[model samples]
Target: MKPVYITRTCQIANDQLVMDGVEAVLDYKEIIADPALRRRMSRIVKMGVACGLKCIEGLTPESIDAIITATGFGCLADTEKFIESIVANSERLLNPTPFIQSTFNTIGGQIALLRGIHSYNVTYAHRGLSFESALIDAAMQVNEGKKNVLLGAIDEITASSADIQRRLGMTREYELGEGANFFVLNATASGNKSAAVLDIDTRSGRLTDDKLIEWIVETANRNGIEISDLCIVANCNTATTDNIKKRLSLKNKPLQFKTCDYPTLSARALDFAINNSTANKTLIISDYQHINHSLILLGRG
Candidate 1:
């Protein structure tokens, strides 16, 4: 298979959402303050379009082939409000707006509706692996010969979801936040860019320290590269996977690994990999543990 080129990428965080390397056009906190569902949806779609425009300047909406999104908790604040309204109103005369905006695919649908894109539309909700799944699907679509694909990952933190995460021992002890990350992919260069996508793969199961290291090494070997060639490693900051750090140290490959400080900060790693990439390659490996789930691989295309 040929390499899949990344045309552009964008991110929306609490204080900032960047397109390519530039700051986003809108602030996430300001958008969340809007009470109306339709207004919120419109704001999100607008921000997406703005970012898309910045990434692929002068590209028309008609050129996009598909829209795919990965959301860990879609419209979480609305979902919580709807549930609260049910309890507050004794399950009577409930407002439908919250429920309507709470669907997982709402963002993707809004984007398509605004852009008039009618091709492959998909939304994945696999906890932390949500973004990875969306990225995998986007790559597959491009590999299948789609010229351009719009891909994004969004997650909003609400008090209710944070409470659940606390009970499940997934969130940190302090506050919770929200954010979105979007990207565009193409089979051929959208313009004159020449980035290469080396390879990507994921695994799910009980993997030991030795097994994880071997898997990563084998994955790199498949692409005709070695751990030594790896300049950086991006991973999630989860205590359960301390062994991964130890194994990397053992390899002594003189590589740098950045552990996302914020839960959604993994997108920051994506930005780093794209901006700071050198020698035509970079590897992004996300290891998520949910009932023994994991996502591992190298990305360069």
Candidate 2:
């Protein structure tokens, strides 16, 4: 597959805006100008729409060939609102805004509508594999001669959702969290960083440590990178990282990317790799609930 260079990175989390690894001032009022529209958007909507808009700030809508987004729980607050409204109003004269905003493609649709972009737009919601799937699609878009593909992943945590996940044992390793991250993919190298998506693969159900290690090595070898040369960004637990280091006989200690309950945190891990990794090849190993697993290989373009 052809390399897809990440030309720009934007993230909005914890009331902060990070662009291209640099922290900048964030004002939603500036990003979403209309006061009335801003009032109606939920937290997730604001975060996603703002992060995406910030991602393509200078580029014209015509240059953006695609808008691809991923989320595990799309617009939960809006979903709850719509459901509650159905119950409250006895399913009569229901407000359409919440229902409309609760769809999986809300963010992507909102971005396209705001920018007047009439290109390919899609959203993925495959649990922990959501971001990886979106990324795979973005890479394919770039390979097919598409330029400036805006890819984003966002998932917001709600009170009810957090309680439910805790009851389901999803919060054993890390607390529930949420954020938004966006990237612009191009076929050619961008700036001095030279970060590009080398490869991405996802798996469902239980994945053993040995199998995970084997996948990592296979991905490295397939990309012409030696196990010794790959700098691993462990998005899984510490025990898993330790096992990988010991079994692979790696020279460098794997950099542990702290995990959270957010299904799309791997997107943040990808951003961390692009900004923090100095190695020629970086591999991010991510696992969620020991049921979903993924390997993302990134390297210089």
Candidate 3:
């Protein structure tokens, strides 16, 4: 695999951890840079474009070869608006604007238009693995010879969707979170201090405790990463996290961030780990459910 470096990272979270408390909603005014354009765009679209712009602040948009996005729940506010419009108008009259912006690919489309980017654009909505899938695709594109890839993971939670998911027993961890995170990746190293993505692997299927160890060990071995050399950032069951820690005898315990089941935050942890530590290597382990797992290895050079 071609080596890729995470040259830039930007995160726009609804609840960014502040000294006193979390910032409930991100202020897009500074990010958008134009009041009229910001007013015309939806919340998710604004967040997406803002995060993408921040990630590639110095780089030219024309240099980007692909724009990839991942969102488990895409444009939730617009989706709810479209549904409410149908009910309010007795299914006869409807607002076409909401309906037009309520798709999974809307974020990617909006970003492309805003940047005048006509490169390869794609969005992945694979529930739990959405962000991981987007990263995988971007890394593949870089390895396939794309110069630069703008990858983003965005998810927003509206009250309606939050309540529905709550009834379905999905929001047990904490209050719903919404955020957009963007990363600019290139095959070549940016500088001596650049953070490099060593490997990214995902597994889906049932695995016993022993099988889990084998899977983890195999991935580490494949990447030639010693377990002792890793700082794991994971959001998994306590038992699973403990088991991995015990099996590997990892020097650094797994790092769990604030949000659970939020892929963008998980991706953000990669950025945090790289920036906050002097360690040469770190790993991100994600498994909201026990069955499927995504592991990302990040190394600094």
Candidate 4:
């Protein structure tokens, strides 16, 4: 696959907005003009829509060729409401709003509806690999001659969802957190801090430490990058990263990027590497719930 350039980035998390590695005012009214419509949107929807709009603010609708989004738990609040309504009303006379907005494509659909972008639009709802799947599609779109591909990932924490996940033992290492991340990808671009997605690989089930080491070396070797020279951004845990470094005999320690766990946290890791990594090439190693794993190689293009 061809390398897709990350031209712009925007994120909203912990009640803060960052664009292109710079802190900015997060005024939703400024991004979403219609007051009534804004009032109707859920937290996740507003966050995703606002972050995505801010990402493609300067670009025209004609310039945007596609809108792709990913989410692990799609619209938790609205889905909960819809389900609760169903249960309370005895399966009758339910409010249509929550059910209407509970789909996984809401973010991408809203962005396209607001921007009048009549191009390819899609969404991915894979467990922990949601963002990576969306990213792979976006890169393929760019390689297929698309421009200004708007790709985003969003997940919001709700009280009910958090309790259920805890019962399911998902919070053993990290608590449930929520954030929205948007990136603009294209085939060609020139600017400062220029970066591109060089390669990506994903796997399921259990991955051993030694197997992970072999995967890392193979990814680097195939890309013509030395394992020692690549700066590793750990999106899993400090202990795992430290072990990988020790076994590989890497001189530079891996940078810790994961504090809390989320399905789309790898998107944040990519954003961090794009802005903070000083190395010419960076590798993001992500381990999600010891079940889903992925490696994304980023390079300065």
Candidate 4 residue lDDT tens string, 123-240 = 9999899999999999999999999999999999999989999999999998777899999998976567668999989999999888988999999999998788889999987778
- With candidate 3 superimposed using the best TM-score fit, by how many Å does residue 25's alpha carbon deviate from the native? 13
Report the C-alpha displacement of residue 233, candidate 2, in angstroms.
Answer: 0.6
The lDDT for every candidate, in the order shown, is 0.60, 0.92, 0.74, 0.92
Model 2 C-alpha lDDT per residue in residues 1-301, reported as the tens digit of each score: 9889998999998889999899999999999999999999999999999999999999999999999999988999999999999999999999999999999999999999999999999999989989999999999999999999999999999999999999998999899889999999999988777598888988999988899999998888888888998889998988999899889977667999966768899999998888898888899999877888999999876
Worst 10 residues of 3 by lDDT: 15-24
What RMSD does model 2 have?
0.9
Local accuracy of candidate 3 as per-residue lDDT tens digits, 222-275: 888887887877656566667877778877767765455554555666666666
The 10 consecutive residues of candidate 1 with the worst lDDT sum are 252-261
List candidate 4 segments past 4 Å from native: none
Q: Can you give the lDDT of residue 250 in candidate 4? A: 62
Task: Give per-model TM-scores.
Answer: 0.80, 0.98, 0.88, 0.98
Global Cα lDDT for candidate 3 = 0.74
